[model samples]
Target: MSGNTARRPLRADALRNYERILAAAQGAFAAHGASASLEEIARQAGVGSATLHRHFPSRRSLLEVVFHDRVEALCAKAQERAEENEPGAALFSWLGDLNAYAAASRGLVASLLHDGRDTDLLQQNDSCKTMITTAADELLRRARQAGAVRPGVHTEDLLTLVSAISLATEHPDDEQAGRLLDIAIHGIRLHQHQRAATNRETPARFSE
Candidate 1:
C-alpha cells in the first residue's frame, strides 16, 4: 500500500533522476496547480522533456506518483499511531495529520475529479482512499472498544468530517483546521464514566 511494488528496478542514476522529477513536480504543482506546464517541470528537474516523458509518460502519471507518495506517508503515520497505547489520542492526532496533508495538497484534489481526469489517476486515488479507510477503520474500532469514541461512528463519518474541515479551510491557517477538528473530536469522544456505563449497557457490542 506504500511502496512502488509494481515498478521495476531502476539503475542508480535513473532512480536519482526519477526522484528529482518527482521532487520538482511536487514544487511546481504546489505553486502552479494541476495544470502546470510539463516543460517547466522538466526544466526544474534538470531533465530533458524526452527524459521526463520516458519516465512519467504523461501529466497524470507524474501527478499520481506525487499524490501516491503523500498517501503513503499519511498511511505510515497512521500505522505509527496504531502502535501507540492511546487510541483516542492516536486517532485524533492522525486526523490532524490528514488535515495537514489535505491543506498542503490543495492543488492536487482538482486533478482527482472531473474534466482533468485520467484512468491512472482515478485508480491511484482509489488505492489511496482504500488505504486511508482501512487505517481509519482500525483506529476508530480501537477507540470505540476503549470507549473513547461513541458507538456507530464509522470510518466514513470521521473522514467526511475531517475532509470537510480541510476543504473549508483550504486557504486558512492550521489553527483554524485544528479548532474545527477539536470540535469534531470533542463531539465523538466519550468520558471515562460514560465509557464504563456504555460498555455495561452494550457489552455484546463494544466489550469482548
Candidate 2:
C-alpha cells in the first residue's frame, strides 16, 4: 500500500492474466488430474492458450507454482504455530493443520510431494524442504524430551507417514487415517511401551 511500491509501473494486464491462469489451473488440476488439458485452462481463464503458455511453459510449470504456493503457506503457518505455542503443542497443532492441508490439496499437490512423483518441486522451489523439516525437527526434539514421542523417531519418516495418510484417504476408509495417526502417535510416545512383540506396524512413507 506504500506509494513507492504502489506506483511502480508493471504490466497490469499480465498480472491479471497470470492470476486468471493460476485460478483456472487450480480448478482444472483439482477436478481433473496432472494430465488435464492446458487448452481447457486457457479457455477457462478467458485467455488464449498462448497467454497460458507464456506464463507457464508446460504443465510442470503450472504445477510448480500451485505446489509452491501451498507449501509456502504451510511453512508460514508452521513458523507461526511454533512461535505462538509450546513445542509439543505447536507440533501437535501443526500436524493437524498440515494433515488437513495435505488432505485438501492432495489432489493438486500430491504429485509434487516427495514420493518420487513430482520432480517439479525439486526443480522449481526449495520452500517445502526448509520449513517443514525444521518444524518437524523442532517438534521431534520437544516431543522426545517431554516423553510425548519416542526417541529415535525419524522426522522424515513421520512426515511421510502423515502425508501418506492424507494421500491414502482419497477413497474409502478415510476415517481410519486419523485414528491410525492417533494410535501411531500413542505408540510412539515415550511413556507408552508396547510390550507386544507381535505388533507389526509399519510407518507410512513421508518421502516429500
Candidate 3:
C-alpha cells in the first residue's frame, strides 16, 4: 500500500499500540538510521511484529508517519522561536535548529529521497516540504521587513543551503552543522555597513 493512503479509524487499544510502535520507531531510526530493525522496534514498543505490521503495513509507511511527525514538531518550533526572538534572530536560530534536525535525521531524509515512487511527495498537499516552506517564508518575510535579511534573499535558497550543510555534515554533528549554518546566515543577512553603502548609492527619491 502507498504510505499516504488513508485508512479507517483505529480502535482505542489498537491506537495505543500504533502510537507505541511509532514512538519506538522514532528512537530506533534516530540511533540506527533507516535500516533499523522492525523486530527491535516491535520489542521496544511492547507489541508483536504482527501488530506493527497491521498498523503500518510496511517500513516505508512507518517511516513516513515518523518523519511527518518530526517535521510538524520542527515547524511548531519555528513558530515558537518567531514569537520569542527578534525577526533576524528568530530566523537564524530556527535555521540552526533545522540544520541540526536534518543532520540528525539523516535516515529519515534518506528514506524520503531514496524512494522513486513518491518523488513528488514534497510538493503534495500537506507534505513536509510544503509545511517547512510555509514556516520559513513567514520567518523570512519578517526578517526582510525588519531589514535583517537582504532584499533578494528567498526562503527556498535558505532551505536549500541548510539541506546542503546537513548533507555535507551527514553524521549528526550538531556543532559542525551549526557552524555552517552560521556562515550561511551571515552571508544572507544585511550588514549595517552594506545597507548604508546601498542607501548612499541610491537616488534620494529611491532611498525614501
Alpha carbon lDDT at 196, candidate 3: 87
Alpha-carbon lDDT, every model: 0.81, 0.68, 0.81
Models ranked on lDDT: 3, 1, 2
Better of 2 and 3 by TM-score: 3
Q: Flag regions of model 3 displaced more than 4 Å.
A: 1-17, 111-126, 198-208
What is candidate 3's lDDT per residue for 1-208, written digit by digit as tens? 2234577877899888988998899889887767789999999999999999998888877877887877888989999999999999999999988887777687655755675544354445357788899999999999988889766678889989998997888765578778888888889988999788766674455332
Q: Is candidate 1 or candidate 3 better by TM-score?
A: 1
Clashing pairs for model 1 are none
Q: Comparing candidate 2 with candidate 3, which one achieves the higher lDDT?
A: 3
Error of 3 at 20 (Å): 3.2
RMSD of each: 3.3, 8.1, 4.3
lDDT of 1 at 184: 92
Candidate 2 displacement at residue 201 in angstroms: 26
- In TM-score terms, candidate 2 sits at 0.62
After superposition of all CA atoms, the RMSD between model 1 and the true structure is 3.3
* TM-score rank order: 1, 3, 2
- Please report the candidate that would top lDDT against the real structure: 3
Pick the TM-score winner: 1
